[model samples]
Target: MSRRLRLLVTTVGLAALAWLLLASIERAIALAERFEGLPQGVRWLVGGVLLLLVSLGAAVTVWWLRPRRPRAPVTAPDRTSLEARIAQLRHDDAGVEELRSELTELDRRRASARTYLAVFGEISTGKSSLIAAMVPGAAPASDARGGTTREVTHYETSAWGDGWTIADVPGSAEAGGEARERLARAEALRAHAVVYVCAGDLTRSQAEELRWLGDFGKPLVLAVNKADQWTDIERDQILQHVREQADGIPDAVLAISAGGEERFTRRLADGSTEDVTRRRPAQWQPLRDALRRLLAAGPSALEAQRENAVLASLHERTGERERAYRADEAERIVSRYARRAIVGAMAAVAPGSDLVIQGALAASMVRALASLHDVRVTDVEVDNLLRQVRMTLRTGTSVVLAVAGNALKAFPGLGTLGGGVLHAFAYALIFDSFGRALAATLAERQALDQADAGERMRELLNEVDASRLRRLADLTGEALRLRHEPSD
Candidate 1:
């Protein structure tokens, strides 16, 4: 259906559901006296029918509004097709060499980069101050007031040589979908170490978060906040909670008070430093020790010493080969056919066409692409393919917000210069759409070259905290390698 019609149906369906629910309640109230006199069997039928209709209507309405996708499972790939694609990728000999070279350079950089350290703790605690103390020019710690720190901040660390970064993610107790997605993306794309932070509350919520972090399969560290003023009773409860939560993860918790000016400047005798060690209570010493232990020995430090020697060699041979595979499928095979399928969808816009011609355009586009590629285009894929193309086009191509701004100011008409302005925008869109489709098709597999190394590196990093690791990624060649630099 057209977008307008689909929206209309949705509005109508919602109205219908509300009407049904309200009507059912009213009918039952009206029949209250009669209901008491009627046999139980008839009353059951009336109530059951009302509920069933409402449930069915709600389900359909939900399904209608959800984004559609091709029926294919996102994770599945048939071996035979994969093999065929791989076999074909061998032809791009020169481009493969260039890709290999780039991969080698990146690997060399990553392997030697200084690791980052993160200071994580929940609201009103002092993660901000902890980082601030470790790095000069860092912001002073402040009370969160509530679950406020909505933005993730980064601070450079003195301990992780140079080229290391520490990222502080916003803390949330009841994290929803966006929170999960943001954290997961940060975990996948950036976090070098994982610090599960919690504050004053020694309740079950902290236990739940800490418990899940245990299984994240990283070098887990717990940052229990506000230890300075913990009563003996609260202290014991907090320690017990920490011990139980850290179970299975062979790591220790860090304790430091980022609040108060004195604690903010507290320095340890060991090579390590604290943002607010002097101001917090004594229990935090053990946590600082745990943070120290993480950097003491591991493959991560060894890899940094050697740089990217092994991975570089591997990429020099395999890098470009992967990109060629994606290019073949997307540019030559998938997108070429996809455009044809989309043009076919235009048939629906033709006035007074037959029902099949008008309605099947959307369905036909999905089926045609799958058939041409000799692949199964699942229902989910059907819904998302065009949308994916459109989304990619919007981002991969420059938006030229400047042009959009001008057009809005003019506010041209349907048949006037305004019309011409719309045409210009339309032209820009067409160029962007076709360009993105072609480019994404070509580069879809480009990331495959780094996927393994990225995962391996992230695994090592996640064993720690993101704040510190990001420092490593963001620095220049020289700053990332020095280990003895004095830290906060």
Candidate 2:
């Protein structure tokens, strides 16, 4: 702005402030005069109330601005307790044999008493070349298109010290590489220390991986690979940025070249061009120095943290297995109850009382599913949940019967069974929808959510996929045949 305009704006701001100040002073004077006119007791009461209000406002301000404490990091249980938990899962038939195998491998590696280091990074980050440079005469496959390393390969190297073993694992961040990333992570946790290789500053995923390693207390070094591509100043800046990004996670952050092959065309004196391949000399002295310092503590000193990391990973795996087991068991229970509902509907002589008859079965199925998911539910809660389901089914009864009629027509064999089969199939859909809705709500909220389950039931009642209808029809047929069989 021009000098005159700037002056005008500044003057206006000052004038506004002065006007506000004068208005506040006048208001305070008027309040004082009114207070003097009041009785002494009322004046004291007013003053006390104003003091209390001001004190409360100050207290609230302080509370709003208070510094919050960070949440404590999660720690894995000791090996003995972790193994006990895994054994309990096995006894429960949770299919945790793979977790058991992980424990077995953990013990085997510990028994070897070797210092293990894993080279970890995303695809095409020179992880393989770095390994080849560290281990003489050891060449690992590398492709410019990425994902060349598919499995974990260990090389015994005495470069750092005796019994030092380096592991080369698959790279992370590949398309369809989630399985390989899991393998790479498990191997990293199995090691005494890890070197996270990156070509530049950390990406979001890379930073997260480093944080995960830190959470497991894994000893780490951040290596900025392919450093030969940048000049000295640029390399130094990148190293500083990497160090800041990794911060407390890695023991050291250094720039190094992994000595990869570069292909180019050479012209001879005869003027004919010849293809030539040359390997870049690896410049990883700083990396070597960092590894030496990290390993100076020896494998024995690092064993506790490594074991903790492995057990923590195993604990997570076991929990996943347990959830899967519960889900499968819940499905079986729902199918059983749904079959029972179909049989009950088929046998009922009175068509109008079918819903009243299925109410008890629905309640039973809810209890069964809740128990399977380890969700505690009271008798009152179960009754209330079933009441809600009954109301939902009442509203969607026509929709459910329509779906059942469509199912009967869809299957030629089922259509000849008569009208009773339509009622039976409707019951099957009802029980199936109710059971599934309750099971899902219990699994997610860990409590009986009447409103959510009722909404889900309404949705499931109208949803008649071909596969579901076929299964229900087959079940009705089987149940009817069994009922007609003579009592031996």
Candidate 3:
């Protein structure tokens, strides 16, 4: 009921209650006067009973008229429900599917008992010889010249009954080697631990490659092969240099000879001793021991590394998809608000009315943008943003357009239409730029502050192209014109 009607009813009811109370008091007085000649004790008992009944009635009325508490609001849905709703809106099915595939692969890898230890290095780094030595009777061909191995070669064996695979990657120094390098890195990413073999001091590129492999957070062992080829001092210098260059990589660095030739004494048939030179078997026992210790660190460590790699890949893929989605959504928002601004401009009847209508339209656009991006903004913040925009326009190209539009309004005939079109185009451009800037800021999950938002708006306006604005205005005009045509 209306407030006035409720007050009227309350007043009438109160007056009736007062009248009844007065009548009851009058009757009680009359009764007391009639009982004045009776015994004093009997009259007192009757008065007490009447007083108790009146008090009980007054208490009941007060209880009935008291206010009630309001009902609680409905509860919100759970997080999973909210996430499902967001997914539906975002429509990121492809990214989600790719993530599912990666996770499934990770689970499969975890179920396997084999531990892969990939050997990564430049060409002619003895990676092949090292693998051959690590696995007896599994010698792979090698050459003195670099780029001998053109593909990834895997040697499978068992160490102390635990299955292991040693992968030898082709030298990454060939012409058009970027593709091969990428493939090698991909192989390294899948390895539980890495063994990087180099015959000499690490080059700048080699150091960078080592660092890149270590970025996957796997255990790495740097083996300086051909240790017997250099003097003791030179070997120490190489080790120290590699350690300095590689920084945190190489859980342990060992000196070993995988292909160094050695001289041995031979007895001739003519009772004379002769010296014979031959390629010695690879002596990589220290390197093997280091690798064994790394693998023995337990399955938990390996699983953790695998999980990190998979999660990192998933994060990157999902991040790319989210960025693309946000960009597309932002463009749609700008186009939508630009069209709305154009409509408001076309309806302008006076020069001053253009400013008021455009300002209100921009405010509405800002509100819609905040809602779409899930940004929390207050009316005061929105008003501040609009004020900044107006201040900026007053001293820029928009001012020139505003003056031209007003001058066009002074003429007759086609002048009015020209003026409205100019006004509409100018407002449309301004709202479009503002919407894009707001979208970008919200995409970064930032609060809408006046100073930063104003700066972004000004930057976007400065970067605006005349041709693009003209095209947008033309498209909007064409759309509006088409809508006004009579149906067939």
User: Which candidate has the top score in TM-score?
Assistant: 2
**Error of model 3, residue 65, in angstroms:** 84
Candidate 2 vs candidate 3, TM-score winner: 2
TM accuracy, model 2: 0.78
Candidate 2 regions exceeding 4 Å error are 1-73, 78-85, 88-95, 138-150, 349-356
TM-scores, one per candidate: 0.36, 0.78, 0.62
RMSD values, in order shown: 23.7, 9.3, 29.4
**Each model's lDDT:** 0.45, 0.83, 0.70
Pick by lDDT: which candidate is best? 2
> What is candidate 1's lDDT per residue for 352-390, written digit by digit as tens?
122233234434533543443345556665445444434
**lDDT tens per residue, model 2, 291-358:** 98988888889888888888888878877876777788888998999888888898655333556767
lDDT (Cα, 0-100) at 5 in candidate 1: 100
For model 1, the local distance difference test gives: 0.45
List the lowest-lDDT window of 10 residues for candidate 1: 472-481
Error of 1 at 420 (Å): 35
